[model samples]
Target: MEITEVSITPLEESRLKAYVNITFDEVFVIHGLRVIQGNHGMFVSMPARRLPDGSYKDIAHPITNAFRLKIQQVVLDAYKEIISENTLEKTEDQKQENVAVQ
Candidate 1:
């Protein structure tokens, strides 16, 4: 298991994006994430929904203070773990696919 690449894509006027590729055994998962800054320095959240009328609102309880910090730590750790697992799986799959072709 390993991390082949970590990439981020930015949207105009939005916070920086987060991209992670994770592998487990012989399977890999790619995830796209966005973390937005909140009013409090210690708080950050991901917006879940936008009103049709055109208003911004967060649907879930924000990650704030110690909670936000903890969440950040967890996310980082998860990203690392997922990458290794996903890489291994993805590589194996590609190998098999190539073998079958030949």
Candidate 2:
């Protein structure tokens, strides 16, 4: 299976930086993955649910480390692209405001 598409929704005001959804082979889609800002750095988190014991369990995850890394890389790459685009947009808006003021 191959990752056909990745969607990112950015968030502010927390360590939870964004939410992600990835599509595989243009058919299968996984939702609710998270991009978290951790002490080490940004990382992809698998979708999980709170169990009865108040612990979290992954609802869906890759079985192999290779596949897991692939998913993480793809998700993180998409997230970074979104962030850069947003930053560029904000900078452009600032430049426009400066021009208007002048």
Top candidate on TM-score is 2
Local lDDT at 26 for model 1: 41
lDDT of 2 by residue, 1-98 (tens): 99999999999947999999999999999999999999999999999999999999999999999999999999999999999999999999999999
Worst 10 residues of 1 by lDDT: 16-25
Separate clash counts for every candidate = 11, 0
Q: Highest lDDT: which candidate?
A: 2
How does candidate 2 fare on TM-score?
Answer: 0.97
lDDT of 2: 0.96
Model 2 is weakest, by summed lDDT over 10 consecutive residues, at 13-22
lDDT (Cα, 0-100) at 17 in candidate 2:
98
Q: Relative to the unseen true structure, what is the C-alpha lDDT of residue 75 in candidate 2, on a scale of 0 to 100?
A: 92
The alpha-carbon RMSD values of the candidates against the true structure, listed in the order shown, are 11.2, 0.7
Instruction: Show model 2 residue runs off by greater than 4 Å.
Output: none
